[model samples]
Target: MATVKVTDLAHQDAQKMLSIINNQMPQLINQLNSTGQQMSDPNNWDGPLAQKFRGEVWPQAKADLEKMKNSLAQLQQSVQKILTNISHAGGA
Candidate 1:
């Protein structure tokens, strides 16, 4: 067995990346909600196939989108914790 340690992770870069992650999370959720509403609009479907897609495929896509949002939320929280830890550790 070998002991391994990680060092040299730039705090400024981590903070910048954290800023981006925080800013984009809401944007992504808003986009998903807007698109989901558009997809649910009945007027958008013209025929049986389109209706089927809206009814069937769209649900899975929506579920996946929800899962993605949840994962992003978790990641955001984790990143926030990391940033807090960084600050506590005398990082930028």
Candidate 2:
């Protein structure tokens, strides 16, 4: 079995990150849509249950979405850095 070089590993990591980002985007969109729908329903504001559910669930969901977004952004940056390093290494 051949040992993979660091550059090969980095390239694979970048592809994996891109795949994760692509998968998460649709989930993020769905979350946004669901949140919007929940807010748009007039009855959602009329009851204690709704208030409690929103208070407990919405913030967590928002936080999760933010976390995922940040993670995706960081992964993208890392991928870009890896690609740049690979290019520079090849040129050198």
Instruction: State each candidate's clash count.
Output: 0, 0
lDDT of 1 by residue, 1-92 (tens): 85533334766666776777778766877797787778677896457876876788778887888888788778878888877777766665
Clashing pairs in 2: none
Per-residue lDDT of 1-92 in model 2, one digit per residue for the tens? 85434566666766677777767675866779587557746576647766765677666776777787777778778777776776666621
Task: Give candidate 2's TM-score.
Answer: 0.55
Computed on alpha carbons, the lDDT of every model, listed in order, comes to 0.74, 0.68
lDDT of 1 at 31: 92
